[model samples]
Target: MSELFPDGDEARTLARLHERLARAADRDALLDVGYRLVDSPVGPLLLAATEAGLVRVAFDGEVREDEVLQELAEQVGARVLAAPRRLDRAAAELEEYFAGRRRRFDVALDLRLARGFRRAVVEHLADIGYGRTASYSEVASLAGSPRAVRAVGTACALNPLPVVLPCHRVVRADGSLGQYAGGPERKRALLDLEQH
Candidate 1:
């Protein structure tokens, strides 16, 4: 046995208990939201999903784990759990993306976190294409609000799904990197990754 669990039986019992709890939750439809932490080139990322699809992706430095969970509980549902299995597909797709093996994310997305024009802006970001960029004004125009340049920036800032949605592909009119939800450095890193 390991030091933490001197008796192997205790570890096994705990594992079984957790398994039972997960099964029971699923069976009873109590698992409203499931989440897991994934390591990436930038930093640790929190991935949350619901029955509909992948919901939120948060950066560790930008948001606290507990805060993310609390927000999900309030905005989504209170039956959130550390259910890694539920987010396996999202985690794998992210891994493939960071490794440059994948250019598009096929995972279903629950964009309830954003609404109205913000949702429209983020949804349009996916069309920016891999390794290509669009100016905020261009994105605003594409999103059908030609004059809402600042609104486009706000939409990117509040995008619930960052890398997957390719919000980092949006830049300034002069081709300068702008503010990002994951910070400027991370945005630069993502752009750099795509360039190569």
Candidate 2:
């Protein structure tokens, strides 16, 4: 009687319900889209995936959760569900990253949200490596357009996948953190976490 939940019935009920839902989701035949909200050192992240791969990763409060899901529903398919199993590998890898156990992600990525120059920019950004910082101009040059530095900045801003692609590793020519999809402080933390 001295506890907030004295009987512990609520906890048991929730665990049982989670099991049922996980089982049911596993049984669903046409589950083309799966999503889950996972916690990160920066904040909560909304991860969504399709049969193709990890489609979107959104930071908590960066955008409304429903808006992120609705965008996925429109971009991928309408069969999205809050299924954690599908995102288990992604969650594990992200956990490893935050723990500093992983320098690179092994999860498959779906870059359908980005195409053309942005896609090229994102791909190049991934190669910038762990603890390495590349300037916008350098990224643009590597992406095959030295004069498209501004476009490179745009690409990073709209990067569908942040930590996985290492977009936070890109910085201003003066070594400033510049803009980040997950905000500047999060970017700084990721960089600091990586450099150490």
Candidate 3:
């Protein structure tokens, strides 16, 4: 028992310290962003949120954690922390979605990473509905740029919040699964999940 408990006091102290630090950071508004990693049918997803709302969702295989954190620090703010509590709601919503119990996400979003045309395209994705897909041409038309089919694809590719924004609901005009930031397999999985 001593071998494992040789530093029991130290472990408890460390836990207490971390709790205090998190609380202080929250109290002072020093936590510009809070993030967590959650498992899903597709893969592990890195969820990030600001005081405003969920900012980014990156697939583990698509982007490295360090890179995502760096991008968040640069584009959002530097005071990022691994505050799981802050993302509890987002994680639960994702779990519900993967379980086929949730069709729509109620999470608030921060779309600062997307701008101009891209923002318009992703914002319109919500209209795509659950378990249904729309072609790039159709999405482009819906976004008020009837000829910008390619641009619609690009917008889905660079969507900041993938699953939450329902970018997987966008497909190529030929009835094919197109590119996804989380990769084609993940897009297929998400689409398939929604179908059942």
Two-way TM-score contest, 1 vs 2, winner: 1
lDDT of 3 at 155: 93
Give the best candidate by lDDT: 1
For model 2, residues 1-196, the per-residue Cα lDDT tens digits are 5666566588899778976776586586566678899999999999988767898999998899999888888888777778887899999999999999999989999899999999999989888989999999999999999999999999999999989988899999999889998899999999999977
Query: Candidate 3, which ten residues in sequence have the lowest lDDT sum?
Result: 1-10
**On residues 3-102, what C-alpha lDDT tens digit does candidate 1 reach at each position?**
6656758888988888788768867778889898999999999999988999999999898999999999999999998888888899999999999999
lDDT of 2 at 57: 91
The segments of candidate 3 whose C-alpha lies over 4 angstroms from its true place after superposition are 1-16
* lDDT ranking, high to low: 1, 3, 2
Whole-model lDDT, model 2: 0.89
State the C-alpha lDDT per candidate: 0.93, 0.89, 0.90
Model 1: CA > 4 A from native: 1-16
For 1-196, candidate 3 gives per-residue lDDT tens digits of 6676675489889888887887788778789888989988887899999988899999997889999999999998899888888888999999998889999989889999999999999899999999999999999988999999999988999999999999999988789888888888889988988889
Model 1, residue 51: C-alpha shift (Å): 0.2
User: Could you tell me how far off, in angstroms, the CA of residue 108 lies in candidate 2 after the best superposition?
Assistant: 1.2
